[model samples]
Target: MQELQQHLEATEQRLDAFLVKLTQRAQELLNGFEQEAVNIRRNDTIYGQAYSRFLAATRGQVQKLREKVKEVEETQIMPVFYRHCTQSSLAGFSSMVYEWRNRCQAKILQWEEQLYASESAAIERAEWQDYETVFQSHLQQYHAEKEKVYCKQCGAKLAINQVYYYTVYITCTFCQTQNIFNPGTSARQLEDTARKLAEQRSRPVLEQQQFYQQRERDLYMQAHELQLSLIHEKNNQIIKEKQQAIARLEEQRQEAVVKAPQLMEEYHRSVFDELNNLLPDLREHHEKFYRAITTHYQ
Candidate 1:
């Protein structure tokens, strides 16, 4: 049992170290992107003439990193996450590594806006706000230029003004399934929104990213707190769970009383399901919306 404890601790450290390595790589990638962003923002240079290509490349980089994060979650995490550990360590998987995933995502969203603004001409013109807003056109012009915002799941046209700048999760009346939206996105991205939604349109996604990040942190925190109680106050229960998990593994290996497997595949599935259950559905639904908005102009 003591050996098992030591092994679990070592596995936890390995998982933690692995997450740090992934983050380091992501940071390195973004550092190169930051330098390119600086170059793109400078309209006086020849590089600025190719801002469109740079922008596409940067977006591609972000997408590539996002996919990598998903791959790690699907592959690397199972080894440690499924093993017998203190409940605290089990919960740590979500708060620690999954939190890193979300933090990177938030950073990417902020950088996306920053990169866009660097070339917006709006940044050079800004004296009033750090966040850029649509300012040049009027509302009537907005209506003429854009299609009505509609529920992607259903064909119902959505009311756009209420959530024009930031993404919102809305339950569609027709489909009764949650849908994500950045309402009036086409108008919001326009240089102006008839001055009515101008302020809303100019609002930076960085501010909105905070809300998403906090929501994720809150879920992990809650799960971590509960797991900590199991570690400290419910140690017996934790031991029983671990023993049962091991016994199942022993049976799977055709061992009655011998040393069992270090981890159960079932435990991994449960931990993964639990960690993802924390916020996966929300993100999955939002992704469809995210794709819609990101590809709107394309």
Candidate 2:
């Protein structure tokens, strides 16, 4: 009986050692998941705030520009006496309006740059958060499995408070008999569990590869679907951006539509007025202005 007790004690010691290793490993994996989740959440919060700011500012500016364009169209018209009124005050007012419009358009361009940068950053950060969630879910499953204790004999499973240990030594949880799991016992039961875990670890890389390969195939089919919805969200943002750009361009074109004929008429009148000997200099200056404006519009 004493010898049996000694064997039981030794077996219990080994089991304790094994459990400690498993628990530590499981905790390490859980810690990694938790840390990654925290980082992802932090990144998401920052990106979300920046994106919201970009959207708000851009929307407000575009709306203001649209309102200004409407007001200008309603309140001002190209005067027939524009050529006759070459006074310094008139030139200064015209210069001020031009400068204001140019400044507003420049601001719109700056906001466009900010929107593009913020949207791209948000997309990348969102993807990272999604990946982190997947990792934590898998880690949760592994930790749950690690909490189960297995029988030393017949490879049966054991649970907390499910079976009592015999003699405080190595004994089968199922059979309640010593020597059943003595040396030479098959490791097949634990081997299967370890194999499953190993397979779990490899799943993420496999999924990522599959995602890339399958992306082209399902693009059209899933465009209307909502499962992989974030991609569609990014696409919608791109479409909205393009539409805003088109509206701005159209507004500028309409403004030019009114100004073009007037500019040509004024050019003819100016040439007639200053035809003495400055024609060459005026033409050269006009050509330069045309080139610069054309470059800007393009």
Best by TM-score: 1
Regions of candidate 2 where Cα sits further than 4 Å from its true position: 1-88, 91-96, 119-123, 126-298
Those runs of model 1 whose alpha carbons end farther than 4 Å from true positions after fitting are: 41-49, 79-216, 231-298
**Candidate 2 least-lDDT 10 residues:** 181-190
Supply candidate 1's per-residue lDDT for 40: 60
How close to the true structure is residue 192 of candidate 1, measured as C-alpha lDDT?
A: 26
TM-scores, each model vs. reference: 0.36, 0.18
Q: What TM-score, to 2 decimals, does candidate 1 have? A: 0.36
